[model samples]
Target: MTTIKNSPRNLAVTVLERINRQGAYSNLELNQVLKRHQLTVADKHLLTTLVYGTLQHQLSLEYWLQQFTRRKLDPWVKQLLLITLYQYHYLERVPAFAATNEAIEIAKWRGNAGIRKFVTGVLHAALKSGWPDFAAVSDPIQRISLTSSLPAWLVKQLAAEYDLATVAAIGQAINEPARLSIRVNRAKASLAQAQAQLAAEGVQTQPSHVAADGLIVQSGDLLGSQAFAQGIVTVQDESAMLAVESLAQVCDLSQATLVLDACSAPGGKTGQVAAALTKPASQVVALDIHDHKVKLIQKNMARLGLATRVSARQGDARQLAFLADGSLDAAVVDAPCSGLGLLRRKPEIRYQKTFRDSQRLHEIQLAILAAVAPKIKKGGIITYSTCTILKEENDQTVAAFLAAHPNFALEKTQTARALKADRAAKTLTILPSDYGSDGFFIATLKRVE
Candidate 1:
């Protein structure tokens, strides 16, 4: 596997095409391809930027390509050109000649001389003629959607939920790179100690509004360093950190207080909760259905130094077998849904997610809530959360769950977040806005029965 550092444009173009053709997640595919190719630090940064920028603004890039090429180009060729144009238009450091010349080289490999001419002509026109007047369009959704390259259905949903202006803001926000936030292992090192360690290595850090322990990384991939190896920090988003905080500060854990982390995979939340538990519990059943996911949770527990405190096991949220009536002191049902909310971080999601995915997920979410709500201990907290912004998955799903299960009650503790959050409801949503954050829906419920 080539590291991102020495990733060539031709290589990146091939990787990008593979992602589209194979229906692979862009981030996963990007890394897999980067590993085989050696790269310089500058090339690594450029490759990373080019890949993400192209994905982030794919729709917009394709918009111009369509104008330049009347013939329907192959998907691979189209993606290659878009990747080239991404650097040409958005990145000032990449010279225009370098971008176009590289595209022509890639085109020659992809097709005949005729295809090379097409690639040359399209990007060549882009450099000379410039972008279109997206603003002059009459339909606001069309304008913003084209400018941003978000799916039309998504734009309509956002526009209906938020005002046109706010939807436009979200579209713009999705184009920016989401900030990297790391959760410090206070158990392993204090925030000060961790920051100092990073500073020694030339990495920069800043506090975040998402969680008290959240740090916005200004430099270096902490994951690739000894700090992570030593269990000092873990990369997670700010919106995600809120899921653990919604537990309302568990001061006691030895009372055999059972906790269920539904949908706990890649184990970020499971580890976060264990870190905040503050006391060793008799059992914290960390569950995910996939066997590989169960292992990932275990790995995460090892990273955060919490493997001994939590049970990482495979169990579906919708069909938890051991969760009996009133059995859990707390249950975090991090339901699966159409992840429209994380579009900024995973730009390919915009293309993959569909309108009906939400409706289907809503059915699954409602089922999971119904089965799990009755299992919460009397007056114990049950937090339902998703890394998505759709109302169907957020308030609407919870409202439906409440209607189905009268035993559950809404707890308005969202307003009680650390000073940085200060959101309205204990049940609420978070949008990308200008913070370059992922959108999330979190609702804390109480088992009143």
Candidate 2:
């Protein structure tokens, strides 16, 4: 018998219980557990699948559990049942008997015989009855919420912002697995050179329709490939790579052009800016609030051999006393947002965030823009961006900033022909359903004064 602590099913329960009860971020908690344990590749893959799959469909799993049992279940018991049900309904590769047996073993190890019997009965009953019809739910919003595993508030909010059809599409898209993408570093190699190098190293690639320098990974170990090891490419979503590309359209990257990455951390955008610089004198100042994250930016820069092009610092975005007024040629305000746009990558955010959180982030975003506004030279561009699709955090925040600062004006943003991005407004909002990339918003503001 596998030890309780070593069993993959048992570990999934522990991770899920922590996330459900303590509000832990699924990616962070899951990674932490994986690092602490010595597990085989197959075991790690199973653990990841169980954790993400269960969280992705939690609302529906709980809804199903409610149909079979009316009793208030313990947190662990509830989590165990949820993962078991996820395997039954979603994971067709797993035999039903194997899922049931593994779940019962985990229950017996974690609890007494009474609990074991209860879990066994619920699994048997659910197997016999099959999934409940969501059509029976009367409220359109509630039905969408349960079926999509989105919160009622989120479903309603999306519905208010978009039509029911669009909302339903977004709900369906975010539950799908996130794609793995990497940006080819043009400073070191062209897209073709990078692709050839990656292929020689056993990784396969396909061009991204959303970003010119982006590639959607098809197969093989990207992280272990020589192209990644030697910094010929770096992992970044196609949508995220667009923010810097949009900035490049309005701002010159010639020698001696100084830019500020106001909220850069782990240095993805900062690295992109560095790679786009035309001469050695062109540089980026990357700032983050935490010291460790500042070091992370520095580490990434050194890894990419772009250390000389970026100056990593720890500071708040709302304050700019260290820099003189109108000193920067351009700025990137990738403001900290509610992360509503990253639902496909971080499913737990749908349950963790609220509409009010976006409202509060709006205030902070405006302040950061205000601080960075004075730092940009006349006719300079400030590229504001976020990983959230909410208008309050995207367009509304930009509108509010422009209203408060008459000196600044919104500029039309253009992406590559391949992206075929929406041009209805100066700002661009890319939904998850648009191109299967992380949802993002980008707005360019020019300082005219």
**Candidate 1 worst ten-residue window by lDDT:** 248-257
lDDT tens digits by residue: candidate 1, 2-25: 322234776677767776777788
Cα-based TM-score, every candidate: 0.93, 0.98
* TM-score between candidate 2 and the true structure: 0.98
lDDT of 2 at 277: 86
TM-score of 1: 0.93
What local lDDT score does residue 313 receive in model 2, on the 0 to 100 scale?
A: 96
- Enumerate clash totals for all models, in the order shown: 15, 0
Q: Candidate 2's error at 293, in angstroms?
A: 0.1
Across 1-449, the per-residue lDDT of candidate 2 in tens digits comes to 44767878889999999997899989999999999888888889999999999999999999999988989889999999999999999999999999999888888988999999999999999999998899999999999999899999988988888778887888899999999999998889999999999999889999998999999899999999889988889999999999999988778766436999999998899999999887757789999999999999998888888999998999999988988899998999999999988998899889989999999999999999999999999989999999998888999999999999999999888886435545668888889988889999999999999
